[model samples]
Target: MRVGIAGGGIAGLTLAWLLSESHEVVLLEERPRLGGNVKSVLTAADGGPCAIDLGVRETPVEVSPVWRHIAAAVGVSAGDLVATTASRVVLRKHERSPLWVSAADPTDTARPVTTGGPAYRAMARFADESARWETEGMSWDVTVGDVLDSWPLPSTAVRHLLCALPASLHGCTTDEVRSLSARAVGTTFTPPHTVPRTTYLRSGNSSLVHGLAAGARPARLLLGTGLRAVRRAGEGFELVDSAGAVHATDVVALALPADHALAALSGLAGAGAWRTALKAVEYREVTYVLHHDPYGMPENRRTWSAGNTTVDGNRSETTTWYGPSLGVDLFVSQLDHRAGRPREELARSSFRATLPTPQACRARQRLGAIHEGQRLLFLGHCTTPVETQEAAMASAVAVAQHLTPCGKRLRDYLEGG
Candidate 1:
């Protein structure tokens, strides 16, 4: 079979790599480079050129079985993985004090603000409640606001965890966070009993991208060629490229975002259902700025953690990632439209992310039905919940399972075989 993959991100790359073993694969990317959101940058340092990931950074190994399997499969040595503790602090604008802080590291002299108080009790309660909520199998339509309203949490706790924290993580406004699915938000922010173990690629995420590309060995790797449109041929599909060229393939897997994928299928017949579902998946534009200045950190440097979020009214909450892994003062801040550009910005890039609203989550569920009995398929964030690399890769694995005989073998590989 001849497979055509659109959008050369992790999902597309993984699908191509899986299919290339038995089929001729052609991967198309609009950008000149691969690794769509897995962008890493090198900066001058005293020891050497330190790599900083401007896009996807850390992966929690416990929850990221597929990512771990892929990294190891691609020859990523154990030395390349650096284990790190994920910590966070939340601050309000113009306030010298922090609204909430995780337990301080042993090296820090400053004590945590919410060690024992209403905020502390609220945090503890939330953890327990969210865990129960998960086990209770809460409805998908339940909004974060609905959950928060039911809780007897203090305003500060609500601001810190449910509002600012999720807003910072998703690169959306606090108000926008209210409409998001409680199940999704709970899955992300629910505190575990112990500190979760996470890891970062010592050389950066691009190493995995390079490995996938090298292994995939697609017959035609078309970078800088966007998929303009898709039309049904007699038995297969015809993909129109940006340069006015049409490529025919036995199967088509669109690993692009919902909007991008929908736009390309404008010429396809019987695509109304696909278009409607795609439109329900709302997206927000997030800009990441890498810089030397602490644009979004708390006023006190001692309270700094791996992730620092600042909450301000009507503005999107900003999260700054302090580069403890790089052993440098480098910082990456996620900003929305409201937050102005950073002063000492070294580099800036923007990306579109799907908001996991109840509507959007429902839309994602319908994608499987839309692709039923059709050669056209959807993968990546469009087909999965939460925009993590692990989810993206898992979606690709599903597609590979559907199209090839090695699907069970691949699933076993992802399950740590």
Candidate 2:
């Protein structure tokens, strides 16, 4: 079988790797490089040059078994997986003090407010209730705003915990976070009973991308080209690329973003439902700025945390990732149109993130209907409930299993058989 995978992101790369052993695979990427949202850069630091990740940085091993398993399967050594700590703080506009901070070591002088009085208590309550909502299977239509409004917590507490925090995480405005489905938020932010350790690729995510591509060795690797359209060709399909070249494949898998996938299939016959479902998944633009200044941090240095979220009026909330993990002074901030660019900015990149609004969530559920029993398949963020690296790889695993029989070794590792 010959398979043509579009969009050389994690999803498309992983799919090509999984099928390469048994089939002739061709991978196409619009960008010169792969890895999709997994981007890393080298920056000059005090000690030496350090690698700073601008996108898809860390993963919690407890929640991301697929990512952990695949990293090892691709020959990424254990030493390259570095365990790290994650601490977050929330601050109000122009305030030197943090409105809330996560619990930290008691002896750490930099920790602000050992106890977060009302806000901490409210957070506990919210976590408990959100977990219960998940256990009971909350409806897809229930918005986070709906749940937060029903709570008796103070408005400030609700705003900081539910609105600002998620806004920064999802790269959206507080108002936009409110319309997100409660189930989607709950699944992504389910407060664990115990703290979980997070890990990042010490060599940066680009290493993983290189490893997958090297191992896959696809029949044809086309970079700097994109899928223009998909058309029926006898019992297979003909993929027209932006360079006016045609590639025929027995199967087609779209690993591109929902909007891009829809546009690629615009010329295909009998694809109205597929186009509609893909179009229903909306996206918001997020800009990432890498700099040496504390653009989005709280005014106080003692209250600085690994992740700092600043909430101000009408402007979209911004989150700054402190550089202590990289042992550098660099910082990465997520900014929207309303925010100003960092003063000491070294580099900037922009991405279109899918908004997990109630409407978008419902649309995602219908995507499977369009792809089932069809030669064309949709994977990655367009199909997954949560936007995580693990989910993206899992989507590839599903497609690989559907298309071919899994070998015992790979099957045992993925399924714990």
Candidate 3:
């Protein structure tokens, strides 16, 4: 079979890499290079050149499986690829005592979630009910206010967990999100460990992209070619590029973001609801200031901590660090918006206010989209299972599984029916 993949990010590359052994694969990329958000740069630092990851700075072993697979495929050990890990997290706001957090696998015990606060236990109870609603094939697609009003939540912490984490991931306030979709994705992952050390790709995240691309080496790997349209062409699919050039393929995976895929495959009517769902979902933006400071050192805390800061009613700022001697990189979560703001200005402000000023700081900002189409098979920093390389890898693996048809029913085989 011949497979054509759209978007040359980790998902496209990983799919191509895994399927190349059995199928003829052609990977299409709109960007000039692979690794969409995984791009890294090596620039001149104070006295010498240092590598800085503009995107995907961390890969935690505790939760990320995509990096592990990529590392294994490329002959890189996960342990060796890790840059730094610290034992403590010191916060600017909570200076009295640092919270002890660890990622060691906690014993799983099915316990009742907490509730009991001024906000009323009704909210927590409602959330639990909404979760049950999803198992029964119902959706909680309403404002956060509506969700809380409809359910019985009893605790502040539970309400905070329900409200904040989803807001951060979905890039929307509780009022604008789907309670069912949000909870479904949120409850799927393992929580962060106290000592949350990020693993840096020594050669940058793009190294994995290049390795996957090299492994696939598709017949016609076109860069800077955007798909403008997709219509039926006999038994297969016809794809029109942005320049009016048309290409045909036996199997087509609308692997771009939910919106892009919807626009390209507009002729297909089967995707109406899927397209609406994909478009309805929202995404958060990520911004960072990358620089090296000589003075105003950050304590050797493992992961940067966020104080009690709020962005549009969301606590986004996590931590600031002064130590890089042990290979620690500064990371910030949650931002206001992804437009009009000057990158250098934001970097300067973040540098001046947080850690000591570095000789030079580089600001990198990226915006991701979240949508609802099921046919598009969208995978990026904004989708299921967290915004990490592991999601991309898992998506690729899932794609492979989907491409293959099943034979006898598993239950029949086991029961000999």
Candidate 4:
């Protein structure tokens, strides 16, 4: 079969790699690059052998079975993984609470985010229940909002702190937290607060991205050209390119985002249900900042090596440090969702990450409608309902299992085998 994959993100790349073995593959990327948001930048003087990821930094080890397998296959082995050693947390509150104290400082007078108080109990209960749900094989019909409403102690500010897990981690606002599945909230690989910091590939995710690209080695890799249109070509699909050329294929797997995929299929046949599902998916955009400012930090100091979250109306902000230990004195701040910090003042520019909501999960479940009348497929965070690398890879694998001749065998052959 002739397989064409739209979007060269992790999902699209994985799909192309999986299907390429059994089919003639074409990987189309709207951007000039292949790894959608897996961007790594060198700060150690161009090619000086040091860099930092401006996006998708954390690579939680336990949660990334699929990614790890693929990475190893592509030669980006386990040895490339690096872990951060910051367990101390600094707490800064907007309301009436303890001032910012260094958790790492032995003599500093700061309290942990969890002091066995109401918020701690609430968080503990949330984690415990999420684990229970996982063990019991239960359906989380309720949202994370419901879980917060389950407890009625402290203040809204404190509740916002609890709500940040879904908002900051999952990508939504406090208002949208009610739309996040309770199960997803409870069952995430590593709840952010407990770990203090997250694990990452020491070399950055670009290595993993490059590995997949090399493994796929698509026969025709289209970069820097956007898909202009998509329509039926007899029994198969014809993808019109930006320069008004067309590439017809036996099968098309749309590994694009819901919006991008929907637009590409504007006049294509069998796109009705797919369009509807794509339209139903809701997303929140966040501005990610890498800077030296400690405005959001406790005492404006580097003591808060770990990210700290604060609530603003329905939105929240998290500050994470890429400090001296990490080879810099910069802090990566996830400014309020959909909002940007001072651009001219800060030395850093803003980057964005997609946040999935409960509505997105609903849309994700409805993707069967897209598959009903079309061989054209969907993948990525839009399909998986979470904006994590593992989720994106899992969605790719799931779709690959359905479309390829021996996809099951190929997927299992993880080591770039």
Candidate 5:
């Protein structure tokens, strides 16, 4: 079969790499750059030229089996990965002492999340119980904030601690965390005790992107060609590019943001229900800025050798600590949804921030219904509605298993993810 994939991000690239062996694949990228949000750059530091990841800084091993498989398959070995010391701090406002934290992995650190006090304990109890339903198909009928409000929350400090992690991890504010569903909160966040030390590609995240493209050379590579529209064409599909060109294929997998995919499919007669379902989920824009100075850091200076930190409350945006996540000393800061532009912005790019609300879960169900029926499939952060490198790879693997001959084995290995 001839396959056409739109949006050359990790999802599209991974799908193409897996399917190219058995099918004729054509990967189309809307951007001039092939690796959607996974961009890497080289900059000068005290040690000379070093790789700085502007997007997707790392591929954490403990939670990312799919990521590790791809990294190894792409020739990125354990030796090439840089692990963090796992030390983290929660510098909340109006607090005398900083709440020290570390990744859940068995790592030695000065401070642990358990020391956050009563509120932290209450939040962890809720996380532990709610996270169990994660595998049992937890209902996404309500927002996470609604559930928290009903719970016996200890104090504002604990509330901030609980919400701060997911807010910072997924690029939303504490308030926005309330808008998301409990299912999403659990999937996006694994309490600090479960959090493992993330590993990064020595060269940068983009190395995996380049490696995938090299491993699977698509029949046609159309860069800077964005999809403008998609309509059913006879037994297959017809795609119209931003350049006014037309292409037809037997199968298509949209590896794009939820909004963009829905927009492209708006005119399709079969996509009426799909557009409605997709519209149910809300999307926010998040900006990641790469800079030299720690403009967003706490008044007290911190080193990159330490892990990333989260500022609680409305000020809940800061650097995810580029130094440790990518083995570089640069700082990559995340701004709250619709926050003012950064001042020391050396590089900036906007990516979609998916809200996993009750409505979103319904939308996801509807999307999955469509996925199960058609040759056209959706893959990416929005599909899983969990923004992480592991989520991206996991979604791709799921779609590949459905379309591949050895799907059973692929499913067996990635099902745990």
Candidate 6:
């Protein structure tokens, strides 16, 4: 049978690679390049050659199975696909005050965001709520506020942590999201605060995508293309392209996000409830700054919330770090929409806000990249409130399973032989 896959992301590519061995597959991607948000930038210098992870930065031990399987299938070791290291976490509520916690002693128990505290318990509760939603078949329609209210926590710290997870993950406050959506994240992966960050990849982290692309069977990739529409063509389905071109296929795999898939299938035939489910889902915005620093920033600097500094009612969690040699990465959500203000100034100010007010502090800016456009089906470890690669992989599997029965076999193949 001929299979047409829309959106050649990790989900789409994984499906296509699995099916191509036994079927004819045509993988369509809307972007000029693949890899979606797993953006990696390779350094041009020689010798101590290294690559920094600009996005999808962390791969915890809890979620290594899928990524490990992908690496193996593509004929590379997990280490080959990542740069693993111990992460030093720093805490500071007010920017440039003092480093409350550091890797030198992350267990000092003085910081607010420290693990194994009220924050961790709240995370556990959130995870439990997410599991409940999934088992009850209510994961699709719930909100973050719903989950929080259901929790039995009375501590202010616990409440703050609960509120922070969804807002940080989705770039939106708890009230702005569905309770089920928030739960979906928890049920999907380990709550972020509890997961171990042991993985980093070289070649800018895009190597995995490139590996999958190369390892995939022939006639699998159809880049710079999108599914414009779908219709019945004889016994099979006719998939349309952006320019109204048509390709008939026996099986259709929409690896695209819920929104993109729903839009393309609006005029297509069959699958009413599925369409409704797809339409019910939504996405959020995220921004990050990837910089190359010859002089490393203080280890006391890391990720924190900026909800207190917003001009409007919105707030953001700004996460920053230096992993590979003088490299600083900042991930900030809930950015203000001010077209008149210069982006560089805002990023610099945000960066400065994350640092100590030392008069002698000197650090050079590297690269700042932003993805402000509407995102689709971003139900993964990175964007999801859950903090495990397992959640992201499971969400992908669930989405795939919803469309076809082939998902089981694909999942099995990814898990093992």
TM-score of each: 0.93, 0.92, 0.64, 0.84, 0.87, 0.68
- lDDT per prediction? 0.78, 0.76, 0.48, 0.66, 0.70, 0.48
Please list the residue runs of candidate 1 whose C-alpha ends up more than 4 Å from where it truly belongs after superposition: 104-110, 337-343, 369-373, 407-416
**Clash number for every model?**
0, 0, 32, 3, 2, 13
lDDT tens string, model 6, 343-362? Answer: 33222211101110111011
| Model 4 misplaced regions, further than 4 Å | 45-49, 85-113, 136-141, 170-172, 188-197, 293-295, 300-303, 324-327, 336-355, 368-374, 405-417
What would you estimate as the lDDT of candidate 1? 0.78
lDDT of 2 at 93: 75
If both were scored by TM-score, which would come out higher, candidate 2 or candidate 5?
Answer: 2
Per-residue alpha-carbon lDDT of candidate 4 for residues 370-410, written as tens digits (9 for 90 to 100): 44345777788767655678878878887776776366436
Clashing residue pairs for model 4: 73-415, 73-416, 179-358
Q: After superposition, how far is residue 197 of candidate 1 from its true place, in Å?
A: 2.8
Model 4 residue 109 lDDT score: 47
List, residue by residue over 287-351, the lDDT tens digit for candidate 5. 77777776555554432224445564454655656655444457777755434454666777766
**Candidate 3 lDDT tens digits, 1-417:** 666778877777776766766677676778687766666666554555444565555676656655575566655655447555432221222233222222211331231112234332433344455556557744323334555666555554445444543443444453433333433433322223222355666666667777777767544678998778776667776678877877777777655755676677677756565455445433345454444441111243333232122223334233233233224433332234422232322232111011000100010000122233322344443244244567667666655655532312212222331
lDDT score, residue 263, model 3?
78
Q: After superposition, how far is residue 43 of candidate 3 from its true place, in Å?
A: 3.5
